[model samples]
Target chain A: MNTPNSLLIRRSRRSSNLSFVALGLVAVGLVMMPYVVYQSVTSSMVMLFVLVIIASMWNLLAGFGGLVSIGQQAYIGIGAYTVIVMADLGVHPLIGVFFGALTSAMLALPTSWLAFRLRGDYFAVGTWVIAEVYRLVMIKFQFVGGADGKSLVGLSGLDPVMRSALTYWFALGIAILTVLGCFWLLRSRIGLALTAIRDDEVSARAGGIDATRIKRIVYLVSAAGCGLAGGILVVDALRVQPDAIFSVSWSAYMIFIVIIGGIGYLEGPLIGALVFFAMQQFLAEMGTWYLMLLGVLAICAAAWFPKGLWGAFSQKTGFRLFPVGYHVAQRFDTPVDSRAPLFRN
Target chain B: MQILDALAQGILLGGLYTLFAVGLSIMFGVMRIVNLAHGDFAILAAFLAILLVGETSFPVWLVVAITVPAFAAIGYFLQRTLFQQSLNSGPLSTLLVTFGMSIVIQNALLEAFSANPQRLDVGQLATASFPVGPIAIPYIGVLGLMLAILCIVAIELFLRRTATGRMTRAVSDDPDTARLTGANSRHIYGLATGIAFGAVAIAGLLLAARSSVEPTAGSMRLIFAFEAVVIGGLGSLWGTLVGGLSLGVVQTLVAHFDPSSSILAGHLLFLLVLAFRPQGLIPARSL
Candidate 1:
């Protein structure tokens, strides 16, 4: 006979020794990447970092927050523009990037008030409209070079090699920090609320959670993260253009990466970004064919693998590199013998 | 007189916008699916009309006659084959799949037609205009307005008087109940999409006659269509006309002040509408 007190309150494994080892290995590799790779390769790496950051933030917004926004490019464009304006005003490019992110976050506060008025699919299109408005408004600002755009004048004095190296490191740092921040946030109490909200908003509200408040918080965070990526993007390009930065293709690419990787999982964006970068490297010369292929791939993925690549893979294998949810386990009274285990292996 | 000219032109432009929006409204009202690729399909129809006219030396009217029904068939088949699968998956999946379709259509058009813009030759109608009191309106504009009204009336009659249309309404209201009542909801959805596509096809031909179109043109068309739909409210057919006219007038009025601010003004109005009257000018009850 078992007593009520004998029951165990087991939780999911947060990290394994192997996960730590992998993390250490990745950190070491990234730290040494500039020395090992060419300048061109470093630029590609910076791009990959930006994709990962954008995809991760998108995943956070849509997958967890249940806000399927299609207008995230607004923040990306705004962030880029902010950085450019700051640089033009004689601020250091590095410092400008930070201010750009701040500006985006501040802007998001008001944008959310307008955007949150709509629900579900309406919200998606509303965001896109807002982004278009942002782009159009940016085009009218001739001081920032308007529709023609302008190059960053602030970074002209830095050595080419040193600038590239610094940008790469900054990108790498931002990418890792963004992922880590997401993981930490998801592991907290708020994460549990988000999970509940994602599964069922009405039920989550019924369960005493402030669904609106939490969603607003998530929206703001997502904006800040995307803004950071946007800031980094302008620095890497050393040029800012409304047409280029505000392009819907940015949103499309983010969607592709998040969906391919696994929308709801932390590890999904990382894998998706890598896969996308690899595909772009090989198939980019195919031009329209590459884009068409991406579209086909997304359609197929949506139909068959709604859980995404990593999502399906994790479900089958029962493996999680960054576990944020609880896993139940059995507890035994006696210490584990050689023949028997206390928890399922 | 100047303001009157802008208003008259805006009203005529509104007719074109109504054409763009009505199809979107019907699809949303009946299917509860926002076809992200709606504008791309319109662009595709325009290109198809251009190709048909170019290859066969058919008149623009003849080309429209050929393409509209063909578009309906394409829409029917697409809903049956591709969109049907995603319908039950949830709105997010439908959105993603349709977005993917948009990308595919846009890229395919780019590949097939290159980046060059193409315009349909309307002969004398392109430049011809007649004075109405103090305002001058182009012949094409009047034709576009008349066609828009005709299409809207036809679609309204079809929905109200037809059995299939009622079934579509039923399916949209409650799919399971409609299914229980022996209505093939899937088939009804297909028909609804087909009708919507037919409207889009005509709009596409009209659009080509009005201006040049390229592969990427669909996106702006989509934004305009979406704005009209939102401004009109979700399920009101007549409100779409009002919405479209409002959008057109706002753009023209803004352009009057500064030509560069034309598109921006429309977008700003959309945002204002969204903020103040999210239910739109004429709100509809639940579908």
Candidate 2:
């Protein structure tokens, strides 16, 4: 028996070369999307961008932060209302989107204080109640057309083509930034802390992690992302309504996308958003049936494939575009010795 | 006089709310799973009652009597199948599955019944009011209150005295130990859900008698029931009634001052309670 002469220290592979190539191609395609796609297609892409952003943020919250909120529609509604109100005050709709996000983040601070009181399922319902309160209160603001809602006032001056293009670009930029921001956050020290907390809260706390502070930050960030998406949605629609914007269906859509694409994976939202968009394009005309199908699909997914489409695919292929977990690789140079045991179990 | 009337009306309103929440309270207490489709199930019961009355020439009361047992069967079947599978997965999976169920039920109802609001006419009972000193309360309101009280008492007694109910309590207390003691936890869960559905069916009839119901109405009802459950405490049956009454009174009082803020007032109170006393006003002793 020969003793091992060489030792290798293993480190997890972060990304494949193929992943970088794919990312490059996707970035270029997005940049030239306005020229490559028709106006109608561009408009639909706007919807896709907004959906992806919202779904990704939701994934981060529930997938990473261990906070499953069904009330993100509150921030969406608030953000839309903020843009509409700002437009009323003679501000450019473009500039108001940031303010909308800022306002949402501010509101999230107080909301987290209240929402964090409850644990698990209670938190889900509590967030929903907060959203309902926001909707009801918005109906009383007679200046913003109250229950009827209002249209964004100042966008009529811009050319239709220019406005659409700009909105599309803004959405694209926001979607890219949200994905990168989440990826960056997850790779940071806080991300490791979050992963620990997600797996076992008691143990994480016992390990000296401040679960409350991390959760608060994640909640605030999610609100800001949803807020920006909401702003973009109103801008694309050119109208805002309390009933429509504050509808829980928005949250449902986000959940569906996240669940279908891959709940915890980084690329899951993009894939989920595209699948949803395709379905919506084809079946939206069927009206209630389309919604029923979505419901059925969501239920089936939760029951049969809780890990989602990407999750199952990754398990089989060992492929990850945005790999966060570590993977060990064995060096081929070390000769196997059956009696000495080739590798540590 | 106005304030007194408002308070009386609010308390009466709370009776219906208690009926809505008792089912939720039971399901939560026994299984620790908050059924997101609970409001949709109640609305489904209402629609079923309406269909029965419309198709057969059965009277409203008979329709309710038939529907209650039918809903119980549905509760049992759903628990044994879909809910049981999801429960094994985890609490979050159960939540998502129920949420999906809610969506499916709402859309199916919309497709079958259309979006038109439907009401169950109970002839003279709906409009008839009796004088309680200076206040006049509708007969339906009194009936709802009496029915709610009867249901709560019956459930309490059942849980305390009956063999199956004791089994349920045992399971709720400790599922693993209950299993070790030879109790079938799944069957117990199904029974609890069945009872909960029966209660919801009765509540649905009361709701239809009081006002119009549509497919979308389930969402609001869900919020109200959730609020009442949270306010009352997680596993406490009697506390649910008190929570419902408090919510009703608060809404009515706000309505008396400003009608538009009535719903908002209840939600605000719920939030305040959540923020200040996360354990709830009358927390369960087991917790």
Query: What's each prediction's TM-score?
Result: 0.95, 0.95
Best by TM-score: 1
> Tens-digit lDDT track for model 2 on A100-160?
8999999999999999987787688789999999999899989999999898978888999
Q: Per-residue lDDT of B1-287 in model 2, one digit per residue for the tens?
A: 99999999999899899899999888888888788888999999999888888888999878887999999999999899988988886557778888899999999999999999998877899889999899999889889888888988998898889988888899999999999999899999998899898998888888988999998788888789889888887778778888888999999989999998999999998998887877778886641
lDDT of 1: 0.86
Model 1 C-alpha lDDT per residue in residues B189-220, reported as the tens digit of each score:
89888988998888888888889999888888
Winner by lDDT:
2
Q: Per-residue CA lDDT of candidate 1, range A235-259, in tens?
A: 9989988888999999999999998
True contacts kept of each: 0.74, 0.69
Model 1, residue pairs in steric clash: none
The true-structure Cα RMSD of candidate 2 reads: 3.6
Worst 10 residues of 1 chain B by lDDT: B86-95
- Which 10 residues in a row give candidate 2 chain B its minimum summed lDDT? B278-287
